[model samples]
Target: MRKPWCSTSSLALALVTVIVVGLAGAANAQGAAPAPAGPPPPAPTADEIKKVTEYYLRGKDVGPILMELVVCKKMGKSAENKSICEEKHGDTLKKGDPLIAFTRFFVPKGAKYEDLKVKFLLNGEVRSTSDFTLQESWTGYGNYKQTTASKPGTWEILVLRGETQLATAKVTVVE
Candidate 1:
C-alpha cells in the first residue's frame, strides 16, 4: 500500500539512522576510560611468594653468599704450623714462610656449592687460583697455604663467583 518513492526514502532514512548509531557507539567506545598508564606489574602467583618466603625462613641463598678471608703465617715449626690452626697462627707473614689463607663461606647447612674460585694475588698479580670448599680434613674452614716468595709486597685474596668478583681481603707481607 506504500508509495514506491516513499518506500525508497524510508529505506534511505533507515540506513542513515544505522550509520549514525554506529558512529555514536564508536565515539562512546573511544571516549571511554583509556587502557592504563603502562603495563601493570606482573602479578606473582601465590606459590611463588610462598616459595620465596620458605627459602628466606630456611636461609637458602640463590645468588651470592658472605665470604670471609684471613691471611697469616704459621706460629712456628709445630704440627699446627703445617695447618691453619688458630687466629694467632695468621699473624704477619715473613719471607720464606708459609702464607695461609683462611676462608669461610656463609651458606645453608649441607649446601656444598663449590662455585667459588679464589685467586691469591701478590702485589696485584695473580699468584695462584684454585677452587676450595669446606673440608673436614683441614684444620680450619678452608685453609690454603703456600710458600712465601720472600718478596715484601701486598697480599690480596680475590674471591670470584664465576667471572664476577664477590669479595676481597688483603694483607702485607714483610721481610
Candidate 2:
C-alpha cells in the first residue's frame, strides 16, 4: 500500500500551526489586548490651539506673567525635547473627563519668591484651590479628575500671585 505524501507540505503546515498556537498562548499569558482597528482622532485645530493660550491678565506687566496655557487629555515630549500636548482639547470637554492644564510663565529673575494660587471655578463659585510655587521662567501643570458628582457647566482656572490675579483661562464642560 502507498502512503499519502505527508512530507514537505505537511511539515511546513505543522510548523505554521505550532507557531500560531504558541503566539496565541503567549498573548493570552501576558494579557495583551489587540489594538483598536482604526486611525486615531484628528489633531486639534488652529482655533482650538489659540483658545487655550488666550488668557486675561489682571494687572500691570510683571514677573510670572502667564505666557501660554494648554488644555489637553495627555501631554507628550517632542523630538526637540520640548513638552507638547498629545491630545489638545477644545473649549468643551466631556463632563466626566479629567481636566489637565499646562502653563508657561515668564518669571523675572529678580521676581520675589512666593506661592501662586490656582483656582478652579464653576460658574462664579470657587470649586477648588491649590498653591503652585513660581519657578524662574518655567512650566507647571494641574490636573482635576472628575467624579460622579462632577457637574457640567462653564469652568475657569485663575492663577493668582497673592491678591493680584496673574491670568485666567476658561472652558466649558458638557455631558
Candidate 3:
C-alpha cells in the first residue's frame, strides 16, 4: 500500500511539471514578436501625376474636379503644354487671360448632373463657388475657369454634394 501511494504521488508531480513547462512555452510564443511602428505608407504616385480638382455641381453627391499642376523643379523640362491657337474652336481663353481650368468628377454612382454644388478654396478659405444641374447623367467631365484675383499661394479645389465635402486638392500657384 505504501509503495502504491508513493508511485501515485510521483506520477502526479511529473504531470504537474509537464503542464507547467507547456504553459510556459505557450506564454513565450504569444509574446514572441513585436509589431512594427511607423508613419502610414505614402500614396502611390503615377509617373505623370495629373493633379485634377473635381467640382460637384449637381445631385445629392458632389464629386471632385481634377487638374494637373506642374511642379517647379520639372517645369521647363518634363512638363509640356500644347497651345490651341490654331483655330477659333480651340481658343477657350482669350489673350492675357488669367484663369485656371480643372476637370470635374461626380460621385454616388448614377447621380444626375443637375444635383451637385462645387466650390474652390484658397488656403482653407472660399474663393469661388458654383452650382450645376445635370439634365442627363449624374457625373461627367467638366471644367471650372477661375481668374486669379491675387498671387496664388496655396489653393484648394473642393467638391461637395449638398453639404458634404467629397474631395480636395492643394496646389501651389506661381506668379
Highest TM-score: which candidate? 2
Top lDDT: which candidate number?
A: 2
Candidate 3, residues 11-106, lDDT tens digits: the string is: 755764564466446433433112226887675443212121112223335433322221111111111212111111122223232434343343
Worst 10 residues of 1 by lDDT: 134-143
Name the candidate, 2 or 3, with the larger lDDT value.
Answer: 2
By TM-score, is 1 or 3 better? Answer: 1
Candidate 1 vs. true structure, TM-score: 0.48
lDDT of 2 by residue, 108-145 (tens): 43344466776778897988877766533212222222
Query: Candidate 2 — worst ten consecutive residues by lDDT sum?
Result: 140-149
Cα lDDT, all candidates:
0.54, 0.57, 0.41
Error of 3 at 94 (Å): 18
Q: Which digits, one per residue and each the tens of the lDDT, describe model 1 over residues 128-159?
A: 88876542111113345444546778877777
Clashes of each: 0, 0, 22
Worst 10 residues of 3 by lDDT: 70-79
Where does candidate 1 stray beyond 4 Å? 1-64, 75-85, 88-92, 134-149
